[model samples]
Target: MMRNQTSSTSQTIRFTLIAFGLGVGLTTLVIGGADDATPIGTKWWPSEFGPADERGAANRITPKKVLEARDLIQDGKIYQLGRLYEHGMPIPGKRHFSLTIPGLPTGLPTGNNQMVSNDELVSGEIGQVGTQFDGLGHVGCRVNGEDIFYNGFKLSEFGNPYGLEKLGVENVGVFLTRGILLDVAAIRKADRLPNGYVIKPAELQACLDTADLEIRTGDMVLLRTGHGKLWMEDNDTYGEGEPGLGLAAARFLTDRKVALIGADTWAIEAVPHESDELSYPVHQWNLTRHGVYHLENLDLEELAADKVYEFAFMFSPLRLRGATGSPGNPIAVR
Candidate 1:
């Protein structure tokens, strides 16, 4: 047999226990924080790195601006700043010998054996030769400890499983804009910047001062170190030891929001540090982290000698979908 107590205090105690349990359930509803089920508006927040009042709004130059620049060039006041490719000049790092691929046919088909052609149609797999611009997608940092696209896209996501349809060389669009050439070598009083010599931030500023040119938004900055000539010497020591922009220099350029930064050298940054543990931090910082494009192996000797600092730049890269990079010939007219 059981005895039942129907007192007001007992009823109140029962109600209190139920209330406490309800309070705990409510607490969890409040403290769980916006889960996947939470409304999107409830989780919205302002971006931290967005444009500030002092800083101008983020803007991109339109095609009309480029066309306006071209119109300025038509005023008959611009000189072309690009190297003429020669047949026998020594290709960098390949010794004094000129470009000649063995087992490759040469000459056009003419006469009896019309089916065969000897001409190496200037096509096929030719290691990027001559002045070239490195596209933004050229090099990338490992994302999540894996070689992935900068946009978090997997490498495999490009193209069809076995065919070129998915990722073909036709994606990189044309680029035309105003170009500013910073003649660092001339300012340094040296014919060529030495290898391993890190260009300091102060020196870069000095070069800009000497040039007396202002860097505008959406401009491509080309830094001439006189190292291109050295590279053309075809000596291993040339590229093995050459002066290049330091990490600070790269930072300075990117801070200006320059669309692209180019140099007349193999790698825009100084030689790899002595410690094997240290690698190309500039590449990781600018190209990967900052979204800045790096243009390497530009031939700027002619332009520097001409003392042409401002120019209209034009370049079109092969639109290779999902390609790490496309070879480009960038021309500067001033």
Candidate 2:
């Protein structure tokens, strides 16, 4: 049941069975209650990193992990897994991305050497746009009038109009770890998984088995749905719902202690989510509950085509003091 991305909230509750499964899993025991799908105000914080921690899953990138990843780079072939941030690129919802040169030559010749330059007046959610890396502060749960973020930090206490005091993207250091790409589209023998298609643990496991690969702790897992094929060609279709991981599948990765989850889809989790009671539950689960990061809107076509299931994945989020997220190109080395 692929729902339009612009559909109303009430129109998305088409999967009662999936929604029920979500409730049965990590969510609350009750299924239909307001707080059942993703419980609010419960004790899901103080993260494993401790009360004051903000660096989330990047904490898993130990020196040993770096060495492990480095060993996978035999050929030194690099795959850029980010899309171009230009106009007409599909942006989720009302988010905008625009880059313009203020003038033909923003700067005139200042010296005898003729140093003319064109500066860009870039606007629109720099951190949240393009190939975005969601930090800990990007999503939170509202509990009884209070917003709780990763480590159970209160939004009222740390959030500022200027920037957040905690869980800033800057707090997350570099990520260099073994990467595993599960080409679900190929395993399913489809060019692209249908919109609203929920990828479960079974599908992920099947892909791993087919590739003779197993996910390891601290690994960066990426999914290729083939939806990225629509990237610039069909912006309208791309902005619509997408196929991605479901809650149960996400739990599977988090249980393996994965450092991050990324996908070709704009939202790594399925749209018209498994539960109507929840919106982007996977985001809340990964970022807020488990301190795991998410890499969205990735470009994985080349990797999928090459059948590069294993590689060294590395990315460093911009050091934007208190930004909730960062946009940049994450690379995979083979």
Candidate 3:
């Protein structure tokens, strides 16, 4: 565990230096480009929010939008969209998670009351673990020898070893918006989508048609691929690959100007992706290009069972200064 953390730290430092230099050859490629000719800077920089905006699509959540979302709550039933963080939960890549009590009684019997207390010692990546929230800092595209994030925030200008000087998770404020769930599994007539199945725009349209719904601006969209069924019961399989959206489907949502996209799967985009050459391109398209956020490893079983397709979705990322992401239980109120 220490070794993994050490390696991650070193990689962070290395990447920081490389980004700061702006001329270093090393960079994480942004695959599945629109064309070989167009530069990423010209295509997606100076976001609609402007050059100085760090809030991204989240800026669309206005008082009117909040009232609009508030109107969605009819039943007053709340659904927890996040999964429990445990020792055996399915974690992606080399990330780690563990929780332990420091002692039988962390605090000795104090005062005359003979009171004792227990405290948990949590060790691992807190921000990017189970039920994670991806901030603007989470993903970036290296364009023309420079690492650029949302709103054209150049990593060379903001990258730091300790933490990002900009685009950190703390910059993302509260998200209270109309939330829609597209149960692609039910649309496909399957309990669980087969691994590596790519959800297309047609399927998304079909789901919306059935629900008599439309993706609106500043809405939070959740896709239930049913891959979450394997979460802890089959960790190995859950981590192997997933059934999720293709680039076109992602573009379909971004076209509607959604504030965020979430999924029952760990990664919202299909694993063993639509293109062998691009890895998690949907992530790049949404986070980097559109300044949208992502919520992952959601528990949508109750919502599916109750047939709650639209509701008031709300979540606030932890104010972890300079952190890349956050972990929290987002809720849906109907």
Please report the candidate that would top TM-score against the real structure.
2
lDDT of 2 by residue, 199-245 (tens): 99999999999999999889999999998899888978877788998
Error of 3 at 36 (Å): 11
After superposing candidate 1 on the true structure, give the runs of residues whose Cα lies further than 4 Å from its correct spot. Answer: 1-61, 71-129, 156-169, 273-276
- Clash count for each candidate, listed in order shown: 19, 0, 2
lDDT string for model 3 (1-334, tens) is 0011111111233333432243312233222333431223234777898889998999989898899999999979999999999988987677899999987899989999999999999888888889999989988766656777887788999988788889998888999999999999999999999888989888999999999999999999999998989988998988888898876688788889999999998788877766444546677778988998999999999999999999999999999888889999999999
Instruction: Output the better candidate (1/3) by lDDT.
Output: 3
Candidate 3: 10-residue stretch with minimal lDDT: 1-10
Looking at model 1, residue 153 earns an lDDT score of: 30
The whole-model C-alpha lDDT of candidate 1 against the native structure comes to: 0.53
- Candidates' lDDT values, in order? 0.53, 0.83, 0.81
Q: Compute the lDDT of residue 327 as modeled in candidate 3.
A: 90
Q: Candidate 1: deviation at residue 77, Å?
A: 7.0
RMSD of each: 18.5, 3.8, 7.4
Q: If the candidates were sorted by their lDDT against the true structure, best first, what order would they fall in?
A: 2, 3, 1
Instruction: Name the candidate that leads on lDDT.
Output: 2
